[model samples]
Target chain A: MGDIEITELRKLTEFIKQEFDYDFKNYAMSSFRRRIQRVLDLYKMDSVDELIRLLAKQEFFFEEFISEVTVNVTEMFRDPTFWRVLREHIIPNILLNHNKISIWHAGCSSGEEIISMMIMLDEMGVADKAKIVATDVDKAIIERAKKATYPLKNMEVNRKNYLRYQGKYTLERYYKESGSEAIINPSLLENVSYRKHDLVQGSVFSKFDLVLCRNVMIYFNQTLQNDVLHKLHESLFKYGYLVIGSKESLIWCDIAHKFIVVNNEEKIYKKIKD
Target chain B: MPKFELSTKYKAIVIGGSAGSFQPITQILAALPKEFPVPLFLCLHRLKHVRHGFVEALSIKSNKDVIEPADKESIRKDKVYLAPANYHMALELGHFISLSTEELINNSRPSIDITFESAAYAYRDKVIGILLSGANKDGAAGMEAIHAKNGMTIVQDPSKSVINAMPNAALARTKVDYILSVEEIIEFLLELDKKYRI
Candidate 1:
């Protein structure tokens, strides 16, 4: 960007911080710019200066901006191999050490993975012993996730993924179709707590037996990624499992040495040291 | 092939394509020497879920190592870096490539324009962007961005391309530096290696 555009973006980010207090200064700029461009186009505004002026004037615009900035592209049982490994090996290994398990779905947009985990736990007959904390940076998305209703069109892909994960039961058992939306069984969320938590700024709330933060860290720059990884490391119990996106690798981070690869292809790591 | 003096200031080569891209890409990559001075980035449209075997297939014909880049991986010379499917790959400030699962632009992940724009921004005049055969206009704006940044832009000749939509779109947007056929593109790259390689 030119100096003027950079100045405008800085001003816009500062204005957002002053008003909404969501720090986006650490976001990767190229992707961030593309998102901002979308927002600008949506508002029919010519520039960031115009968008900032409108943002300061309208309360609802902030929410819309939050939704645009925080990506919510997720599906149930994403990466079948990862889910398979979790079911066949990781969860069983965790059960050997502790009867009750705690999982944090960091950046869990729309709660597909949380529901997937709940289904896995239910299949294992350990639903009563597991607690899942599902969090995202956007509150609106968290509200949507809490509803647990997804468009029926998306069910086919979810079903295929579940089948590939070698699901013990049909995926249809988890949801009831009504109109064009499929309402997930509310029982699946009995052990889940949905919250709006910024992974970048929020403190690690509790220790977890496993922390699944798939596909979220790819949006962050190296510094923010390292900071979030450190926080994730601190949030896990000794030898806790950390599963990131399939495309992501922990090889470049400072905390990489602190964890050993449980499954390199699936990006699953075991916290080996404190 | 005519002898060409490639500017030594160029730091990276970015190639973007979609449908009908694989053969031309293979031909160009096959001709590049193992010690090619600059890193080559390939942003081709592919199935996101079926990620394996693409790099392996491309490596079969190329002398240089071909592999899909992981998130935040640093760019290295003489390696062919393929953008992972379902992710938008961007050039970061530190000569590293950052991957994002952000919303797809132009109905495609690993959108040519996104990577091209990012490369133009990160490397400015040191980048060379090539838009090849494809069935869509994904790489047009990216070619414009590269040209606007004083970097070099090349597009396959529409008549010679297997699918002309992509190069035609690019040509419509900007005045590209070269409009080479697939065979000519390979010769052009070899000429660059001959002129600039240390």
Candidate 2:
């Protein structure tokens, strides 16, 4: 694992933004450098300059860069305690507020959260009450999310997480296992729309009752995080709910005053002001 | 071993351990005074799903606040920053903590390598890295990184560790500054605290 100096990193990031039109300029510097090293190792390159030159010469290799940088790793029902809270507390309150609810799954990689939310809605007998808009910056992952088919090896982790979440039924009941893939019941996708919307550059598509941008902003610097948070705020209705990643918070951001902490431990906040 | 003054000013301390390390970590934290000037980082391997109680358990024995830092939190003095479960916590330039869910390195999410390399890259020779007992080779590369950056490196004496694999693996990787038993490790910390005061 070779290291990328700060100046080399800035050069590569600037090159990508100017040539490829993908803005990694505002990413968290330390992690961004490490991810670039992964690309370098993958291509057997020795320096950042080589990576930049190859990316410039080869047009399609840009996708490889996107895949490396935005790795979008997710598991079903991650942080089971948060799911328990969402099931027992947050959902019921959101149900009381609107007869029909809308949820924006910002950075919804592989649609696990949407699937988890659908299961929760079905168990709570509110499947018909919500519409889900799941978006990722990568269209390829958006396709993967819509298919909702996962490797069979990953099901064990998902099943354990679902059990910890205390689901009403075993997770196996929701998906049929083929030889190597577990294809989730496609009916769950009926109420969900999948799109490729870049959170960093794209405008708000709709107002959601609950906007879930979980664990996605850790890749961004503080400036980009506040920018994304504001976008999430604008995408939500007044007095609506905002759920960030468990380790992420709103207290330190510029918009902290507009939202009140609904559950500090769970990282749930309610918008008190638009 | 030339002491290298044993009193050089240090910016940060990163300690990583796994199996059979909890008691020694507790003793080290318990022995350090509340006004400890340098920021301490602990990246112990633990269960991924159970996120709540580890810090609280450690805080019970220590006077300093034992916190699992939020992503991008400012590195501050007088705090025991425990790496949270399931997230790889790394140090950044300008003294910030960065967390990521990058693919598991050496079958560990909080790979000891990630934290140690980041701290070494950010602070270079000003950081002190310590590796302790564990069941795997996760911290070996980390110890090497610290050594390459000229940071002070310490590992628990492998013979004294309940599981010798971790410390022995690190010793196999690089030349360490110290190989101390758990008791000596605690004393070294207390003495290091006095150096910070000077």
**Number of the top-ranking candidate, with DockQ as the measure:** 2
Q: After superposing candidate 1 on the true structure, give the runs of residues whose Cα lies further than 4 Å from its correct spot.
A: A1-4, B1-5
lDDT of the structure predicted as candidate 2: 0.89
User: Once superposed on the true structure, which residue ranges of model 2 sit more than 4 Å away at CA?
Assistant: B1-5
Candidate 1 lDDT score at position A225: 89
Tens-digit lDDT track for model 1 on B88-188? 88987679888888767888988888899889888988999999999999989999989988999888889988899999999988989899888878887
Model 1 lDDT tens row, A132-237: 9999998899998899999999899799889888999899999999999999999789889988889988997899999999999888877888999999999999
Q: Please tell me which predicted candidate would have the highest TM-score against the true structure.
A: 2
A116-183: candidate 2 lDDT, tens digit per residue: 99988888899999888999888778888999999999999999999999999999999999989999
Per candidate, the number of residue pairs that clash is 0, 0
TM-scores for all predictions? 0.94, 0.97
Report the Cα lDDT for residue B102, model 2: 81
Per-residue CA lDDT of model 2 for B80-196, tens digit only, reads 899999999999998899998888888898889999999999989888999999999988888888889889899999999989899999998899999999888877877787776
